[model samples]
Target: MLKPIKRAVHFDFHTMPGVDDFGENFDASLFARQMKDAHVEYINFFGRCNIGWSYYPTKVGYPYPGLNGKNILGDVVRECHKLGIQVTGYLNAGVHHEALLRHPEWSKVNMKGETVDLDPQKPFNGNFFRMPCYNTGYADHLLAEIRELLDLDVDGIFCDCMLLRPCLCPNCTKEMLARGMDLSDEKQVTDFAEEQRRKMIRRIRETVPEDKYLFINSLPCPLTKDVATHAELECLPTADGYDRFVSQVALARPLYDTVVYMNGRFQCCWADFGGYKGKAAIENDFYDAIMNGASTCLGDHLHPNGMPEADIYRDLKEIYAKIEAYEPWTDGTRFQPEIAVLSTVPKLNQSHYGVGRILGELNYAFDILMPDGDFSKYPVLILPDEITVSGELREKLNIYLKQGGKILSTGTSGLMPDGSGFALPQWDFAYKGKDPMQIAYYKPTFEEKDLIHLPWECYEPGILLDASEEDTVFARHITTYFNPGYDGTHFNFYMPPKGETGHVAAVMNRGKNVIQVSFPLFKAYMKTFTKAHRILMKHLLAELIPQKQILTEDLPITARATLTKGEDYTLLHVKATYPEIRGTMGVIEEHNVLPAGRTVAVKGEFSSACLLPDGTPLVIADCAGYTKITLPEITGYAMICLK
Candidate 1:
């Protein structure tokens, strides 16, 4: 098997044809030395960029006009090899501008009979805007380029922009017709495109040796797990933010043995020259990767002059050096989650993002699971908004519930395939279609009313549920006076609550293990970021699984905590640096040093507790069923190990 990537760099070199000084100051030895200095174990260099310009002299493709005769790809591979660093040649598989321009017939034609492009208005704005059909001769040309990269003795091939996009090109249409698939049906066209993409991936995987790495980017991780050697989560925090990365890591960890979290050094996003993120922000990304049992791959764009920004390497050296120190503890550790959230879809969606963010903020260790995931492993399973329980999945859930597994479902989750009622008999409530009111209010029971503001406005519509006599109503729904709309002469800016409707908003069955919330709380929380929504979720989760794995005292809501288990020890990671929203981006420039009064109570019987790497012993005390440890003053991030 190929070795796992610990610390890697994704060097993007997508230069347009008009660049005059492309690779003019190219120094392969200097580039390798810089990467080695930053403690990079693997480097993904460019073999063929999206602009359809090969970095080196190629027999099958167009070389960069400014390269003249210099074989930059070959030189970098040979130099990086001398430093014991692995390398992967990157090829833009989907969007090849030069190739599409050369052979316009290879371009994918959409249903509108227009070529598939990112922006229909600006057809020639960017190199990546135009997409080429994979079923055409372009596939053969791409494979020939891959063969050239393999002959260069690189470690592997990394194919970018490998997405399944529906096409109506002549080649695709002919293939669909031959297969007796209806070209008019959108689903059939999409399925055919998926098959074509997969066929190409299979060919590439077959060509690559078993010992070499192969990564197909832009596809769902589970769909490509068998063909792709490892999972690369390409999430740039500045553009995509932290929630997407967190959710993707949770989804990818269980499928692949080696998962690499790819973030960029750019302040904004990819290909931003002279843009740099703060040291603390980059450190947080790397720490998040290791804490979640994944490797790190920092992204950087090579300047058109073929020189790397010296400051990027300087920051990486400090951050990666810290990661290297903690590798012994994090190398093979697995996440120890106390809860599993049954995802509404196979891919990452708003529900997953909301649940993951809320759970992380609440200091709860959880995993995002598919419908077929092992629900018995977690103490509680969450069916987020709109999880359709098929017969097979319902059987699995029933078995899990019988084995004392708790379930917290919201919105339309747990509904029957026909949407008649709840699939699980334990949920003693009748689903009475969706409420007509677009904006409703939630009122907690008297006992829990002080938790948050009563009559909390729900921005989105929710399902109406009638709880059975055996069910305990925890919260009631309050109807609005009227939805915010113009009624001829009168217009309302916001909907005002019109007294309680006596309908159940949140309820628990007699078993006390199954709790159901009528509203689409996950989606509402994601879209509105309402504190009440998260508060209600936290309260319900506590009621479901009262004995949590990790409990914190005096920890701020902005801080995040996670638990991972090694062979001989359990690791607790705490991060306190919160990103501040500036303009359109979340920027993290400063680290918050928490005071020393904070304490963490872990539900385990470990004999000793100590800080990681430095081996600083902490004060540990044993409670009835938990171990309480007084943490040291933490700045940005800290890890504790219990044995």
Candidate 2:
């Protein structure tokens, strides 16, 4: 789902040679023409990033106050905008030790209560950066400087810091309290951060055009950028990135898809996926993001210490050749579901039954979304075997449903609240009839208009393919294998062979809409038949309020996408991970050149033989078709010209 149509390169010109001793000899007009010639879509002029400094003039504050005439941002923006290359100047929100020294009151106190300076002692130990108090006078001053770019008709604003993770400072705590929240709990603190970030985005939105983007470099706390045109995350490969998983970094993909399905505002990711040596790994990470949802401004920093190396730039050019083709993958189907199901979550229903699997395999259509209240955003609410919604939320659900909105509650959906730790214990009691904790309960009625009566039972080695209306299923072509001769089937429900009873699973239909429910855990069950994530998705498409689901195959899996095509051609991504397991990968042939090897293997999976622009191949994982291909490499992705 990480495939994105729009991309921006962070031009870290910090170490670029000055035009003159007073910042002149660097040939301004000439370089602007050079940037336009680069054919780049967007370039964020590094006015100030990486630490306490400014590339442009500022009357409010100045570290290099002695600098004389020429200003960098003004020159770049003026030249680039005329050449059709959008420009957004950068501002290091945090990270320079020198800035902290200049604005002592703006500095942050760590857990040790020590003030940190953004500009550290010259040698650099990474210790100087700290989270500052946002409600302070310094932030106001910073905002004032940022205001200058808006006057220049900048395409967007690049905020280097101010993350979705909140600061535990006094101002932050006070603000949280004022917002009907607390700072003690982690989620609450996170919520507070998200809320504040949202406000930041709102402010930026208020400042620019609806199409302008905002790059909030906060990682874990990135949802605030949800409402912006596009958002950015920083340093996924760096020390503070998605802990280096680059692939599984979580955010608003699951939760926000309901609103901005594809090419929506929730598009953002940290460009910081560190350095790449090979053309393969580089293409791998790049396309993997495209397949998932977004690839906005991925950090391809050529140097660690700002020393731009020739070899690294070569790699960037090669990778860029491949990444540029991400546009084609952006035009497909859009999946905006309503009834989001809660998964193997730590909290949920405590008293259901059975050692269960196959909710989706059962052909149930439960919206695969991250439930974050925005539940109100959806008209009807469906609760399946997962767990019960909190009492307060349950009460809200009851109200919404009673008001004529349908509520699909099955299994032990409403058995109890979260405080009791009702997740597994309760679920086991309902599905299995007995738990080691001696928990037990009557199974939920499979009785519904959509489900037909069929004698079904689970198997030892394989799970059930028990899904209904197969035509509607999506990309269930999972190469994720369970080492052959793998003992123990996940869940196989013996069916009555062929009948209406055999086809339908649990379904809730309102005269207005129908919601299908399913539980397909491919990791637990090795058999592909048992995965009904698609059968349910079909229901989401035709029944649960019109949704256009795009799939490379007919079965559904953890990997999914929403592409905005035809109109502008963009791809939005949402991805998840599987338990430790690998499967045979698939490689599709594109391009005129066919290599000698049977296929390229990425992280062990055979690659799709499509030639990326730079000749690197597009390799998709066997498991869930996780993949990446250079956008320019594939001719199929070329923009179709209508007569």
Candidate 3:
């Protein structure tokens, strides 16, 4: 059932006593009505919050000081369950204000012997949450709270901020010393802390029944593979940009049966009481999540009166009604991914996000696959910048190449595990060290017309390459003599190019279906958005995987297009929303309109093509063995279902 969560909302009731309440004006019927109006099947209500106070009548942990014997949590759970909506209990595990106040020693101790919390010297300067070290006796107290909350009959438990940062508390230091480990070593301390975090999750799992799901917030780092029951990515696109919604979802969806995109309704993050995102912004986020095969969970904060904010729920109801109508097309659908970006060394530098972004912008269906994943299913494999390959992985790639698997390796990606030299010899390209220029440029050898001198904006260098006769060079790196600087004589307007075009920028080993770029193409694009970056990537991708399932005309970079296959039809989700950086906050205050002249080309046979929700047939024309379908004027988001 894909973890039994489809449309949901996360109530981040992390409130303080003076500013928070306990169902003072909360009406059960009104609460159930709001949930039903929103069409949410699951909800993450608060049993506890970061301030270390319980909502339900609790005996293990401290209840809200001002609650006055109100079982608000139990009351909400009963109401939501009665309305046929599942509830996941929330526990603010990392920052327990009450625990820190009761046992000061349990607070996380930095190397400087300072507890990690809001700095007294600066107001709102440091992190507001006071993290408690899980390695200490605080773990036992947290577990006791979890067990106490389990008796409330929740469908699941979500432990928030469960990560264990580098701790130097007395308990942690003593354990490290006993293990014969150096306390000064950051890696050892961090790894030990991570193990302790996992141990706590295991303890929670053992305490809970098998049917109840236990999820740790931000658990992608330690429990990436098999530890978590489901996948949930905390993608606050407004804070991190809308591109992150696709990047994070693509990375997590392939690994888990169900993926949930947790985004806040605030302009940036959680705990903004009056901050409300525009209707277009919320709709775009929800559409993007479902298009990428993820369930949607909009995060919101309750008011001090324990009442569901009427304005937020009013907008949510309409947004989720649209989602409810589109769920039939999204559910049980398989996303056809033709490209895989390998995120081998996630700890070092992984360009999955950059690669995924570029691929999506170009209307390519792709997935971010780990190094150990089976790459044979994908026609093209992208080894993004700085992905060092182990001996075992190198062998696997070598064999996969012989089986006609295509590879697009970027700068230093095919390097040996120790970062010495190239592990795959089929490319027949030798790295001639990093380019000495501050900002290099790409010169396409074969182009329709003369191109602008696209400056490699960032200070990152490109590796000079020497290709053998077996490889064909499509582009060359243009190096500059030196960076122009302000001097006494005159400030140079521009730097002069070296005019030496011997270094190879991009090469294609057609015999083995391998394409290698000497520069860190994906990383460069991530750092700076330049036409040159997209131009070169597009050229290389076209040469490697020319045939595409879908193509679009006049598609904006702000708009993302995804194609998924249902049992009897194909679903196309076109989402576009312009989010301007308004006064240091990234928000979509206005909805951008999509012109009517835009068209989508599908490379498949369909009996009929029509716009979704209304079932209006579109004129599908045959163009070069592809079906071209014209799109209507879209205001924010549109879904096209082809049968």
Highest lDDT model number: 1
lDDT of 1 at 375: 76
Candidate 2: count of backbone clashes, pairs at least 3 residues apart or interchain: 89
Please report, in order, the local distance difference test score of every candidate based on alpha carbons.
Answer: 0.85, 0.40, 0.76
Expressed as tens digits, the lDDT of each residue in 342-375 for candidate 3 is 7764332336667766887788888777777878
TM-score of each: 0.96, 0.53, 0.93
Candidate 1 segments whose C-alpha is farther than 4 A from its true place: 116-125, 178-185, 446-450
The predicted structure with the larger lDDT, 1 or 2, is 1
lDDT of 3 at 609: 84
Task: List, residue by residue over 1-643, the lDDT tens digit for candidate 1.
Answer: 6888889999998887788767778799999999999999999999999889998889999988888978888999999999999999998988788888899998988766788456756633465456888889988888999999999998999999886668899999988999898988988998888888888889888888888889999887888888888999999888898788888988887778899999998898787787888788888887788767778999988887967888878988998998999988888888888888887565888888988888887788777777757778899999888886867888998899999999999888888978788888888788888888888888877344337556987767888988888787878999988767899988977667888887889999888888988888888888988888877887788898878888875688888888889999999888878788898799789888888858888997888999988999999999879998888999999999999
Error of 2 at 182 (Å): 10
Best candidate according to TM-score: 1
Model 2, span 1-643: residue lDDT tens: 2223344556553332232443434445665565444334577666664555565676555534334544667877887767777787777664544556666666544434456534556333353256545555555656765777666567777776554444556666667689777556768776665565555556655665556555554443224435544544343221312122221222334433311111111112223234332333333334434543445443433221223334544555555555565445443433233344433342222211111123222222233324444455455454544445664555655565556555443333544553343232212212221112111111113233343333332112221112233222211211112222424764333222221222222434323332332232222133333323323334443454333232323222322223322343223232222222123321122222222222211121233433322334333345443332222222212211110
- Misplaced by over 4 Å in model 3 are 1-3, 20-22, 116-129, 221-225, 345-350, 417-419, 448-459, 483-494, 510-512
Cα-lDDT of candidate 1: 0.85
Lowest lDDT sum, 10 consecutive residues, model 1, at: 120-129
List pairs with backbone clashes in candidate 1. none
What are the candidates' C-alpha RMSDs? Answer: 2.0, 12.7, 2.7
lDDT of 2 at 623: 41
Cα TM-score of candidate 2: 0.53
- Candidate 2 regions off by >4 Å? 1-5, 12-38, 63-69, 117-128, 164-212, 219-222, 225-227, 233-274, 292-296, 302-388, 391-415, 418-643
